[model samples]
Target: MPSPDRSSDAVTPFHLNVPEEELDDLRDRLSRTRWPERETVSGWKQGVPLDRARALVAYWEDGYDWRRCEAALNGIGQFTTTIDGLNLHFLHRRSPEPDALPIVITHGWPGSVVEFMKVIGPLTDPVAHGGKAEDAFHVVCPSLPGYGFSQRPKEGWPVPRIASAWIALMKRLGYARFVAQGGDWGSAVTTAIGASGDPAVAGIHLNMLVVRPTAEDLADATDQEKASLESLQRYMQDGNGYSQQQATRPQTLGYGLVDSPVGQAMWIYEKFREWSDCGGEPENALSRDEMLDDIMLYWLTGTGASSGRLYWESFRAFGSDKVMVPTGYSMFPKEIFRASRRWAERQYPNIIHWNELERGGHFAAFEQPELFVEEVRTAFRTLRTS
Candidate 1:
């Protein structure tokens, strides 16, 4: 195994040091944004209303503090490395206990390294940081290949390729055996890591588990399963317009989104509302600034196009292989991942723990930090014993 890339020696520090001029430019552009008149549809029927988006934009332009969030992020140990010829950005914080297990946490699309921001201090320095030493971990949260600070891949890269790169990253960090955790696209990547059978990857914890629909399960499904299937069908129907567009014609859509912050926010906002169980208003569960923080990452980095390319890559690899690793699944009430335990077992016979949570939505880490952290901790505990 390669030695940890200690070329930097001490842990690296991070800062959200944007030029003052750039912030001024963003503010100017927001002020100059040309808006369209609203349609007659009520609620979210017509997507984000013009008035609502205007309110959000107003807050983003006047009230939000990017530096504050950046300072909070910089408080943690951040690092960057060239892996597979791409510049990779990650937050690497080690527990006080030298022997603590190393775990890599990956963030999904529309999510920067922001989701883990709330959990890092607690996970890495659990004792002085406020938790048990046993729950301590050396946490590494990487911005995906084509997202955030990480340099985008010239061409499309699939989950397996990304998983391989993560394995290489862990190896580079001097971790002979470590665990992986993620949700959404992060979940997909985590599954691929285990499925790759990398000996160094001790276990995998995923909030979004994907399994093939069995004939029997679909043929005579339970009322609950049927309800789930209907929900899935509806998502594929009403909610998957963006997915279809991304998978087929992301470049065509990218032209408009790249040029307009409002368009970009609408694209992400639609998913945040549709996929999450946010009780009528997405803003109720997620602060407007929090929403804009995520949206701005794509806008500033101009990653809206590359981030959408995951759908195209995923479509190519979907249903072609099965991941036979010791995997744990955390089922949130709002996600459309309604696979039965039997179905999941068939695909992943080494399934260790399958948790069904009563609260939280797709953004489990951000929405329910304590519960999500506990699930990951519990899953690793079981995996360690096995």
Candidate 2:
């Protein structure tokens, strides 16, 4: 429990115990949701299918359990520390392996720390999950300010600011040096941290590499680069409506999402379907309970507006700087945007590891925990020794 005083550096252990009344209210809201008529087009073209939405809501109201998620979070060891006047929440699990490397994994939009739950065990205790002792990590997964349990900012919390906070966080935890990994907004922050020339930041890795292709590069593009461009174009044309709305006018969009559990569920649910390797069925990649566990973080905290507001704050800041650290990247096929190795190497001049994975998607850890864990272990192994 962090003290009420603002800007305090006092780190406090935190436990999650959502009131029973809030659970009751969530069920009540789910029961009363007035769903719109089903989409005219087939198969998620219009949005989350009406039938799927109703089924998810029905399960959420009846079958889903928040207590399980809460207990899991507490079991993982939750904590809070006031950084820059915001009470930031994070999960810190120290490895039993003596020489474990400290690593912070950041999650992006439509996600919370819940994204890393499956991978945390494998990452923090590799021996327990069938990996080498050398692959073990002291894992820290933070709720990005204004996203999950972290305190919402009244104004100004762009990506760089978040990166600085993370640097400070690692230092506060007695990690004199560490590596970083992330996807989506997490990639941008990790890049910024690597770019900061902070000796404490040993290296970085990203599942989503953000790099702008030059016109010259496009003119002489390889087949893979051409495919990458096409995928990005499709996203810009069709899949980017949420970004435009959240980046420019999150407040207007937040009202409905904040007030309605169904709205928040669908908003995130659609992304899980479209972004994962699930092939239009999100449940194929993640269980209903897993999805609801994440959704509950937002619904329970009433952070629908605050979370979307991150795009408004830092949407345009991606790929703004080059990273000089020994960077690594694992490209999951279903990620929204991907850059070719050559293009990415130019931006990340000291790239140490680069692999284009055959399976997985935007939510790498959540959808394919084994693959994600392998990628991280492979990426940061040298850094751990160096």
> Which candidate comes out best when scored by lDDT?
2
| Lowest-sum lDDT 10-residue window in model 1 | 1-10
Reference-based lDDT, residue 176, model 1: 85
The list of candidate 1 runs beyond 4 A from truth reads 1-14, 128-130
Residue-level lDDT tens digits of model 1 in 1-386: 11224354332344556677877887888899998998688888888878888888898889988887667667786677776666677888777878678999988866778888878777877787657887778889988987876777897688888888889888878888899998878878888887787788788888877776788888988887788788888887777788788889977888878878878988898778776768868876678877777887788778888888888789656433466767788898988566677777876778888889898888888777888888887788755534
Q: Estimated TM-score per prediction? A: 0.93, 0.98
* Stretch of 10 with least lDDT, candidate 2: 1-10
Q: Spell out the clash pairs found in candidate 1.
A: none
List RMSD in Å for every model shown.
3.4, 1.2
